[model samples]
Target chain A: MDVDRLHRRRRRWKERLMTVLIYLSVLVALLPLFSILIYVAIKGIGALNWDFFVRLPGPVGDPHAGMANAIVGTLELLLVAAAVGLPIGILAGIYLAEFGGHGLFSNSVRFLADVLSGVPSIVIGIFAYALMVLPVKHFSGWSGGVALGIMMIPVVTRTTEELIRMVPRSLREAGLALGVPRWRVTVSIVLRTAAGGLTTGAMLALARVAGETAPLLFTAFGNRYWHRSLNEPVAALTLQIYQYAISAFEDWQRQAWGAAFVLIIMVLILNILARLGTRSKFSTQQE
Target chain B: MSSSATGIPGQGHHPPAGRTGSGGTGEQPGGPLAAGGLQFSSRPRRGLADALFKAVTGAFASLILVLVLLLVLELVRSSWPSLKAFGWRFLVTQTWDPVRQQFGALPFIFGTVVSSLLALILSVPVSLGIAIYLAEMAPHWLRGPVSFLVELLAAIPSVIYGLWGIFVLVPLVRQLEVFLGTYLGFIPLFSGPPYGIGMLAAGIILAIMITPTIAAVSRDVILAVPNSQREASLALGATRWETIRNVVLEYAQSGIIGAIILGLGRALGETMAVTMVIGNRPEISASLFSFATSLTSVIANEFNESGGALHISALVELGLVLFLVTIVLNSLARFLVWQVQQRNGGAARV
Candidate 1:
């Protein structure tokens, strides 16, 4: 009886100990995030002024400089990425969700989507360079956009497919019951029904690629001033942050902090917006 | 974020082939699959719109397949020069002298593999812990917010982690390295000049960056184990820990391994964060405190400024290697996870 009691007590103690350890692990997992957030914010507070947003990035230690061109470039690049990525991603998703045959072919598409998402962004840079830049023999914003676009395809495809699949099969039946053409039903009823969720998912993918730097390193190939055309090299917020972080100047490093902080805010805002959108009635509805 | 939301009913809830494909073959008119009477409804005439829609969407789907195939072809073509020049020597050779135009990837490969494995070792336990806490222990109200925050860590840009690593993590790592070197100097892994930005820092950052992928995936897998098993264990007089250790962990083991391999793929492919703090040396070392450079980092640092054709070719070859490695890892991970979920009676929820 005493042994049984002792054994039970020991087991309870072991359970208590492991529980504490697990709690600590949570603390460890979250520590870096909070640290990065707080540290970058604290370091970047000084650079959040209007001039920091308005002026061009100056020579190494210059105080009156900003990432104006980079900010614009990032937006421009995103626009290009959206143009290249959205149509193909959404259309491909429609194929998978609406028309894909349940066989080896559709399975491979979905499988490849996972594989592509796991592909390093750097390889995409190489791909862009080889496909677009090598023939042109120069770096350009278009290549960077292409790289980010390829990266976006899988995420956008999966999300769109998922959201569209959630649209009630009964809804589809009703549309067909009205003798609506299948394409019309898909475009008007099904796509429209899931539009909010699709938009959020796209936003999440955009948020992810917006901070990409490696692919742009060789493809977009950072520019100092405003780019004249899609053919020219473009600056990206992420590339600028990378360049500045590694530079010898402390002032440039400070700007790196500011840039990192801005990038984080952009990503976090997209994430928050996506979550809110995910909570929209259509998505939160019972499957 | 969709995957991160995880338990949100419709988010990632659909299997790719679960309810899809009315067989899509336009030849089947008003047959078995046409019962829904959607596109294949009996009609007086065959319609162009339906054919066109199917054609266009099919074309787009086929394009995805073609795109990946083309990407591989492009990589092979671009890396051909280096492949021809280096032959099989490229994999095992150590020297990467750019001036004389000799390049070998042994060091970068070693660094990438070692640092990633180090991250896996350090992170899997912490990740599993977080997964267990959230899936089995945490109050229902807390799961949503905590899971979101952890996944947000994954979403934060790699460059942001690089920046933080440079200024924050490197310094802290230096202190730890020096302490370890001071007392545990006898061990090869701990003995070296305590350069702040090196293998250990890279591993630590990778571990932190990778924790979310594992934690979230494992949490989902564990949550899917069905509560009845837990009830049975509890009814059998097992302690909560015993139930979790013997049953929950057992049931979710393969899925957890898949999650870890997925994290491994991400670690192997990660570029920017490692680039910022890995000290950018090209030498293999037993000491984790030594400077190192990963395959992706070497490509990032040198691709734009590569000296000549061979140099660029070499870097592209390195990228090709990285790509193939990640593809293999991710494919393996997906297969394992799929196997378990298939047995579990459905596709996994993300």
Candidate 2:
């Protein structure tokens, strides 16, 4: 009886120790994120006043200045990237999930996708710079968008493929049995079933591309004024944050925090939307 | 929303055809609707569309692969002139003058390797410990939230990390550097005055950034270990710790190690953050606290600033080196994961 009690006590103690360790681990992992967020938010809030939002980044001692060019530039670049990348990514994904057979060609394409997914964004920027800018003798929004789009394609394609594959084969079989064309079956049954997931994937890809700085540094370079031309150098939130944070000026430093805050918030919102889209799809499937 | 509910023009599922494609072949053995069917009737059109789809998808995938190949080719092409001029001296020489169009990559290479090695050293053990704790000790309720938070760490942009490192981490490191230099000045690595924004600081920041990836992947692998193994170990008079150390960890070791290697890859490719905190100076040094420039950081710092053919080529060469390092790391990680999977399958067969 005494031995049994002793063993039970030891087991309980071990379990308690495990619980403490778990909490400690969680704390260590979470602290950096919390610190980053809190710091950005606190410092950034003071900088987001009325004039700061309306004005462009100007001369030294200009307290009224804001990242107006950056805000517009990021939107334009992202939109262009989506326009170029989304269709290609979605189509590729459709082909892979629906039409792919066990062949050398299919295997090679899969290998390519994996390799593309792993390649760093900086290299993509370099490639774009060499291809576009060297010939043009200019940094432009188009170059940046192209590079970002290249990075986006692999992610979107991979995610879309997985989501499409998640759609049951039975749906396609049923359509085929009803004399539906293979294309029709894929379009109607497989794609419709996976629409929510595809959207989430696209959004996630967007979130990823938005945070990139290295690619934009080379491709878009940087703009000081609000410019609408795709041929002109464009600023982005991440790039602005990079410039401001690294510059010697104190006001620029403050602006960097504000930009970082905005970027983080935007990303978090996109992430939440993606999660919601995924959850709804999951629940609908269950129903 | 309404369109989504009903699906678009071609998206609705037709009723089941009551027949299953089970027996001998995909084709029906009967004559009436056997040979080709409606899909076959539009075979030419379908064929065209299929070809178009294949072409587009093939191009998309191929473009990505080509980009990687092109990067290597372009790097080689650009660096050829410099390679011809410098011969074997480029890797050894430490000079980087743009006015005279002279350059070398030894310092950048040294800085990159040292910083990455330092990051790996610091991150691996802490990450594994976190993984073990999360996989073995965390309550069910806490697990998801903790994992989510760790993933969120990955979502924060590298620039934010750089900003934090500049404003927060460097100052803290400076205090430590002073104390260490005061106490351990006899050591060559600690002999120099700590500028704080250097290799050591960059490595520490990188370790923090990569810890989440390693921990998350390691936790997944550790959690994948079958409960039966743990139960058997416990049944054989092993404690929970002993069961984890002897049975569960041993089973998941390959995967955990692969996860660490993956994190190492991330550390190697890390750009903006490392660039910001690494105190961009182009010189080889044994001291971690001294200002140094890495391959990626050097390119980033000087690609725009460094004019002329040879300088650009040298920078591209540096990128090539980085690209190769990652490719090797990724392939190795994939192989390790595959080996682990094969081992698990073999155990199952047993």
Candidate 3:
């Protein structure tokens, strides 16, 4: 009886110990994230100024240089990528969700999308280089946009498909019963309903590709000066950060932190907005 | 409603039969010959439109498949020159001199594997602990916020991680290495002089980068374990920890393995973070404190300055290697996750 009592006490102690360990583990897991964010904020805030947003980068040793060209170039690349990727991704998603008949073809498309998403971003850069840069014999904003666009496709397609699939089958059936063409029903009824979720998905994908530096390295081939055409090499936030961080100069390193701060802020805002969008839409649907 | 009058047979359009029959036979039989002629012409056009829509959407859907195939084919084609030049020796030889036009993939491959595995080893325990805490232990109110914070880790860009690694992690790791070297210097792995930026820093940063993925997936997997399993174990006189160890983790082992593999895939292909801290030395070393280079990092570091066809081809070949490794790992992860879902009798709600 005494031994049984002792064993019970030991087991209880062990369980309590394990519980403490679990909580500590959570702290340990989250330590890096909080540390990085706080440290970056501290370092980055010191470098920000009005000129940081407006003035172009000066020469290597020049002080008070800003990444204005890179900021504009990043937006242009994102614009082109969105224009190219969104329609294709949404249409393909529509096919998978609406017209897909659970056949081998649709299955293959889904599988390939997953595979493509898993492919290294640098590999996509290489692909863009071979496909676009090789043909044109130049690394241009177009190639960078195409590389990022390809990276965006799988995420956008899968998210759009999942969101569309979540729309009740009854909605589709009702449209069909109304004597509407299937395509018309999909476009007017189904897609309209899923637009909020689709937009959230696209924003998430955009957030992801915005920070991709490896792909743009070979494709955009970063320019120091402001580029005005898609045919010209483009400056990008990630590329600028990478270049500045790697350079020996302390000022460039500080600018790299500034760029990182901007990039992270943009990404976190997009992520939060997407989550809020999804939450509100889902809550409304539940109601 | 009158539009049902033009319903064509065998076109898969399910216009209501009552409306179609009444409208077509009774009303439109001999009334308004022009209207009847217009309806007849529009039927074929509507059928054509349906076919056309299906064909176009199907074509767009197939583009993903086409793109994947094209990627593989293009990588193979571009790397063919290097593949043909070095043949099998390209993968085994350690030399990589652009001046001598000698190239090999062994060192980079070794570095990639070692660093990724090191990350996996360091991260899996913490991730599992967090997963268990979130899935089985955390109270309802805490679960949502904690998981959100974890996921935010994933949302941060890789380059940002690299930036942090350079300024923050590398210095800390350098100090840690000094302490380890003093205490564990007899071990070959801890013998080298700590450079502050090497395989160890790269691996630690990678661990931080991939922790979210593994933790999130493992949490989902653990949550998917039925409540009955826990109840049964508790009823059998098992402690809570025992139940989690023997019942929860045992059941979700495959999924956790899958999560680890997925994280491994991410680590292997990680470019910016690893490159920023890895010191970019293209040599194999016995100590974790020594500099190393990965396949993706080498390509990113060199593709811009690569002068000739041979140099570019060699870099492409490295990419091909990284591509193949990630693809295999990712496919395996997918299969494992699918198996877990099948075992759960539905999606895991992740």
Model 2 chain A: worst 10 consecutive residues (lDDT sum): A98-107
Q: What stretches of model 1 exceed 4 Å from their correct place?
A: A282-284, B1-18, B24-46, B347-350
Can you give the lDDT of residue A145 in candidate 1? 93
Pick the winner on TM-score between candidates 2 and 3: 3
Instruction: Report the lDDT tens digits of candidate 2 across residue range B41-123.
Output: 55456556545645666666556556657767876787788878877788788898877877787888888878888998987
lDDT agreement with native, every candidate: 0.84, 0.75, 0.83
DockQ of every predicted complex: 0.62, 0.41, 0.49
Clashes of each: 0, 1, 0
Error of 3 at A175 (Å): 1.3
- Cα lDDT of model 3 by residue, B132-158, tens digit: 998898999998799889888888888
The sequence of per-residue lDDT tens digits that candidate 1 reaches over residues A1-287 is 99999999999999999999999999999998899889988998866778778888888767788998898889889989998888888998888888774568777887777777888989998988998999989999999998999888888887777778878776776776777767777899999999888888888888888989988988899888889998999998999999999998899999998988888888889888987987875445764
Provide fnat values for all models in the order shown.
Answer: 0.70, 0.31, 0.59
Give the candidate order by descending DockQ.
1, 3, 2
Q: Which ten residues in a row have the lowest lDDT in candidate 1 chain A?
A: A278-287
lDDT at position B306, candidate 2 = 73
- TM for every model, in the order presented, reads 0.95, 0.89, 0.92
